[model samples]
Target chain A: MARVLTIGEPMGLMVATEPKALKDVTTFRRYVCGAEVNFAVGMSRLGHETAYISRVGNDPFGQHILDFLAEQHISTDYVTLDDVNRTGMQLKAKTLEGDPEVVNFRRFTAFSYMEPSVVDTVQWESYDHLHVTGIPPALSETCRETSIAMMKAAKAHGVQVSFDTNLRPALWPSEDVMRKNINYLASLADIVLPGLGEGKILTGFETPEEIADFYLKQGAKAVIVKLGTKGAYVKTTDETFYAPAYIVENVVDTVGAGDGFAVGTISGRLEGLSWSEAVRRGAAIGALQVQVESDNEGLPTLEQLVAYQNSAKLSE
Target chain B: MARVLTIGEPMGLMVATEPKALKDVTTFRRYVCGAEVNFAVGMSRLGHETAYISRVGNDPFGQHILDFLAEQHISTDYVTLDDVNRTGMQLKAKTLEGDPEVVNFRRFTAFSYMEPSVVDTVQWESYDHLHVTGIPPALSETCRETSIAMMKAAKAHGVQVSFDTNLRPALWPSEDVMRKNINYLASLADIVLPGLGEGKILTGFETPEEIADFYLKQGAKAVIVKLGTKGAYVKTTDETFYAPAYIVENVVDTVGAGDGFAVGTISGRLEGLSWSEAVRRGAAIGALQVQVESDNEGLPTLEQLVAYQNSAKLSE
Candidate 1:
């Protein structure tokens, strides 16, 4: 099995069970959430040897996250327990359709204390792929330096890098700083994933082709532009194509669709599938995520993925 | 020493160390805080046998607060450890003058699950006084019932009751409801402590004597009105007078000054001090609370209080 590695902050998520504004929501159902959390769980479900790295506080939320990761079969050997800082928490308001309203209390959390020392312990040579997002750089100066260090180490060890340009303007000090740092990291990855909106801001481009061309010129092997309901567009030195989006009649929550897409694409490529086939799987998984509620719960196993693909073929 | 009992939700307080708004602040110092927390700690410091009743979660914040209560020598025999619901939390911004900005996340907490059964378990006959606030009734229906039940039990066992109209308008559904419930609770107490603004809204009276007469007619033996810098105005069935405020040159925070005032007044009476002398102690403690950053850190021990009184006498 291909070993995949990803890192980011995992926060305690308090999901409102009832449909109400956050101020009016009295009771909530707690869950574990993060961008990298979804990607790791998705990779694990597809039979990949996925390992996650991060720091958690000596709090109940931290303990709960560790137990959850263990249950999902993701290795937590690299996770460190911090005694001083606290685990981050977020409260989400429930909605019937579209994205839920979320307020994150993640500033100065335990994860923000992550430094370059943790990256020094990682066995980069043993991993086939490394997954990362723009979030770590936005956390703290140390986290930014460490994220860049990890990516550089991956390249030196012949490990394939996949970077997701997940823009969080609120977490960044300024737009100029966020764009500069995010683009630099994306240029270091073999495959870069950016939503249409993120692409426009990061590259100052009007179209998906222009956005893809901007990253491809920076030495990226391939750049994928997510086009919402229109699916995704990809551009490489050799070829370019579009992966049509699957029709999801009822879109429940669209929070983790990007991470799911990353999971399907990365897992498909690791299975020795063609680039077009990998992009198709990414589209299928993105469709699956919007139909369910929680972040990684909708991720399909290898058997389930094959079943879903076969059924889609029959319908077509 | 007199046995003093009090009940309410104790929360994990994260106080911003820097003079920035909560959104701009990164690091915060954690502390155990609540209305009753301050009162209990104050009473314990004065060598009173103080006991606190409430429910806390199985989370880290809950455990931390329990440890803190134990450190202050407040009896936790009646505090229940809830496994399901979580302990509430609040984040306060640092300010140089007046009250600090506070954001509370206390809805549907572990303490909200408190029922009348908890009141039934209390050894009412052994306690000399029961302290309560308007906050408990605003928590939930079960908590309101429990609070009312505790007060009824205190009266039946000849235990004196002191009600603090610490108005929390945001926690209530409406102002009318708050007035109705708080006034009902105040009428049942031997002494009622209401801030000037609270007295205005609750009784629609412009003068302290008029507000005092309102509660006095409703069966309250004494009514104490907190008049901010003007100190306090007290009207018992027998006497009426004003306790002038102490000169506090530098005011840091005024969040828990009322609780400190309540602690001084209650503890003084338990020591068999005259009403005027007790109110003077209340004014002194309130002055001290404004000089410190944390809620209960400024609350003086018996020794410190005596020393402060002696020093103030020398200065005067």
Candidate 2:
């Protein structure tokens, strides 16, 4: 197992229990989730030492988040409770098929109140890997500056950095700023992950090869590309390959597929697996994620991952 | 001091800290508020033994409401926390003038989970007055039935019932249904209070005299009509008159003015004041409410109320 660190907001998620429009739905089941939250859960399930850093409101939602992270076996040592701001929350509609409609309440939340000083207390040298996402930087200018500071300090301390292009267009002030800042953050990481659809928007590149090459040229050691259900495209300095996607007949929900893939790829590399094997692991987890309703709930443990891959290979 | 009792929801109100549209504003100051909640605060401040009965979610907002009511010296012994439903919430935009843009998240809230069983537990006979609102009935059918049940039981136990036609058209299913139900609630009350604007819509009567008579013929002992800054109109079997409004130079938020008026009239009557004096006191409090930011923050204690009324008279 490797020691992993990530910085992001964990929001209180309220999912509708019935397959009705959110306006019509009255009852909702509460859960804790976010992109980095999903990533931490995946890493923990695969037997890694993981710690999360963020701020939540001093409210019940904050208490719930702390309790949830503890239950997931992820360290909350770096997490803090903020008094002036509220914890973020999301309301998602239940859908039988396709992506569920979501309404987010994250603006000016506790996580958005985070500043560059938050990075000052972290013991960066102790971690083997640092995972960062685009969402934090999109929250506010302070967060963007803080995110860059974290990656730079992690590098200064010899910790490996991974950046996920988790685009949140609504959070950004403008698309031009989003593209420029996102690419700069990507340039700071050893590994960069971008879904194919967002890759086109972020890089203005039409093909996966061009997109991966764009990031590779920006100083990243490897660029992993998500290709929806088709699989993933991988490119590194030494070699490049394509990993086939694990296919499921019915897709339950596609909200957390990319985070699952990131978990597999990051965990694999930490265990010293070759790029092909790691990408293959990522593809398998991404497939598993789309078959569940809530984000990260479908993520497999190390044993479950191996068994699932073996069953798929046998059927093929 | 009268033993005054009321049943209603106490909501978590988020008032924007800046003068901006709600969608544009991010910083909010939290406060506990609601129409009935405002009325209870006024009654409690006026030396009455006020008791509030309602359901709230087992969340931070619910805890805040509980703490707030307790601090206001209102009894919360009958309030219960519900695990499944959430406390209602309102998001109000900051405005320099006119009514603020408001967004409500009150449908299917914990208060709506109330049933006729709640009325069974209340010692209605021990109370001198039962203050009810039309807003509760508009929340949902269950709340409507429960409101009626409380009134019926209160009447059976000889508790004086004062119903406020606080018209909330959006909460009801249809205009026709809202009219019928609100009028029915008025007929069950010993005294009926309705804003002149709402009175015109609910009774199809253009003049306050006609509107008051509409309810008097339905068996009400008295009818009081709010006439905005122009004052209030009052009618009883023996007397009919208008209490001129205590004018305020610059009005603040008008959200809780009616509740403040109800507080004054009810408290005045409980202290054995005449109908004319009670209406005059109600008008003064209603004017005072529109001069402050929060709903009940401008409400004065018994001493302050007397001082304000006396000062206004001396100046006149």
TM-score of chain B of each: 0.98, 0.98
lDDT of each: 0.86, 0.86
Model 1 share of native interface contacts: 0.00
Tens digits of lDDT, candidate 1, A1-316: 7999999999877676678765445345567889999999999999999999999876656777888899999999999998767777876668899999886767677899899888789988779999999998999999998899889999999999999999999888789999999999998999999999999999999999999999999989988899877889989788898878777888888988999999988888899988889888987888788877677778888888878776653112
So what's the TM-score on candidate 1? 0.57
- Report the C-alpha lDDT of model 1 over B60-163, residue by residue, as the tens digit: 56877888899999999999998767788877778979899887767567898999899888988779999999998998999889889999989999999999
Q: What is the DockQ for all candidates, taken in turn?
A: 0.03, 0.03
How does model 2 fare in lDDT? 0.86
lDDT (Cα, tens digit) per residue for candidate 2, span A284-303: 88888888878889899999
Runs with alpha carbons beyond 4 Å of true place in candidate 1: A1-33, A36-316, B313-316
The reply for model 2, stretches above 4 Å from the true place, is A1-316, B313-316
Q: What is the DockQ score of candidate 1, to 2 decimals? A: 0.03
Worst lDDT 10-window in candidate 2 chain A: A21-30
